[model samples]
Target: MNKLLIVGISGVTNGGKSTLALKLKELWTISSIIHIDELTKPMNKLKYDSILDYHNWDEVETYDWERIKKEVTISSQNLLNSSRQLACLLNFYNLHEHHPILFIEGILLFNSPIDEIFDIRIFFTLDKEECWKRRKERVYEPPEPPGYFEKYCWPLYMFYKSELENKIKVDSSKSSNIPYNINFIKGDKAIDETLLWANKEIYTHLLNY
Candidate 1:
């Protein structure tokens, strides 16, 4: 029997967290994914910032972290109980009884309160220009304010990045709280290239497990 691992995919907005999660699911049939956006507070419930004149959806407080943690914990427990699907990972990876992966992906995952649940964490780093370019390509309801990207999104992302780095530094020194099994991947690579690299990393991790 292999351990049940909760994998966290987190990074800047439009940084391909969800895309990579879906690709991983396609590759590993037995794996399950939980997107953080699905558990966020609705528009009406979100806090509105009068200065920015838009809802502050980019902060850590906007997500119900407790509920998200509970759901991940419960789902992870359930995934561990399934003996039939467990064989699929072993067969696919050519490893005997490899870990069962439960992926939780979202922009704010790294900064959230669920650090204890992650066995492996992958953070995508994107240049600000690339991030803005991708944001422009997508359309959102209640359309982004005139300066949303500049005034709100990017700044918040930087803050979160700094926050995550600080936590990593603390954990590295103390070796107590957050697990040190974190991989940083550049987000500008082609999707196939990123996917291939991620597949290799996951496979290698499983080999050692």
Candidate 2:
């Protein structure tokens, strides 16, 4: 039987992780695509509402990191219950028994223990300025306060970067004109271009294995 091909797509927030995941899902109909952000959205919404009373960053800073981390972890784990749902649905279809591919896309996917679960890992890179600009434009709740990106997400991403090996990193800030040799697709390109690149790379990797 073919073993599962677990591809992890990860990057800093607003680095196009979700867009790339959606493109890959479109490209690979046979593979299952899981987006952790969708699962975590409800928790984020609740937190956003609850924090509205806090005037600004300084006020929010009154909360300690240790307590914040514990709260966030619990919320995140609750959100991950969706993963269990997917696993059950897959088993219902006997997906793993038949050895179908699986792709999980999220930020911090390579953070510690979860890093070991994937067979292939891809990171999307973008300039910090570009990321900030995109985050500001998001239609949801509102933009994070200035410095939040640097203080929070970037440090975690850098930590994950140091630990990742056998990973493909794609520069998402580049225009579509430039050609990349890797199978990992960047969000800056057209869907067709991304699909072409992804299909070629995925097939090549499968063949090699």
Candidate 3:
């Protein structure tokens, strides 16, 4: 297959997008998964003056978009020479597939340039309180201070929601007017069920040659 299949899984922090992406990656061993969180890096480390001196990692600016777009475009297009070069860059020497499935997951992707590249988009959802609880358990380099969640995290998440509210839906499958590429999934579902649903959708696009 010379054509690539690109799947996007996006949602709020602790909304289970990574868990699903990892499961999908493991299911299809040849598949490549690009996680936005892993791609994130702060702009500077020496300029720190106070607790708030560091850039907010939760915000979208921390990610390297130029690198991401280039790699993702190459992966999706499956240009043979580009594929080999990218594999070398990523240090995965064994990857020989010319057209591999690409799964990209991130916290905020709706309004970004990265959002427009996916062939299929899946957005996970969970209750705000549940998300907050899970987010608290996760660690950050510049640790989130007291009132940070209330002031920064929650507010930014809400802003994200506001941008996507009119554009996306909670249950796109139930409505015929919804776009075929956009899918909504509830993160509270059983892991097996979620994986089953995800695998079904992914495999449908991968008609066995």
Question: Which numbered prediction scores highest in TM-score against the true structure?
Answer: 1
| Backbone collisions counted per model | 0, 0, 0
Q: Across residues 1-209, which tens digit of lDDT does each residue of candidate 3 receive?
A: 23556788987777888888888877764577778776665557223326654456556676777878877866556544555566676766433333367889987766577776777788887788888888889988766676677766778777876677655554353566535456778878887898899888766655542
lDDT of 2 by residue, 1-209 (tens): 24456677776666666666677766553455665644432232333323333122211222333443454355445434544556576654333223345677766665534556566666676666776677678754444555555655566555555544333234344555532222233445564665566556667667656
CA lDDT of every candidate: 0.79, 0.53, 0.70
Of the two candidates 1 and 2, the one with more favorable lDDT, higher being better, is 1
TM-scores, all models, native as reference: 0.86, 0.56, 0.74
Using lDDT, give the best candidate's number: 1
After superposition, candidate 3 runs with Cα above 4 Å error: 45-54, 74-99, 169-181, 207-209
Residue 170 error, candidate 3, Å? 15
Query: How large is the C-alpha RMSD of every model relative to the true structure?
Result: 3.2, 10.3, 6.5
Q: Which residue pairs of candidate 3 clash? A: none
Off by over 4 Å in 2: 38-99, 140-143, 162-194
* The 10-residue segment with the lowest total lDDT in model 3: 45-54
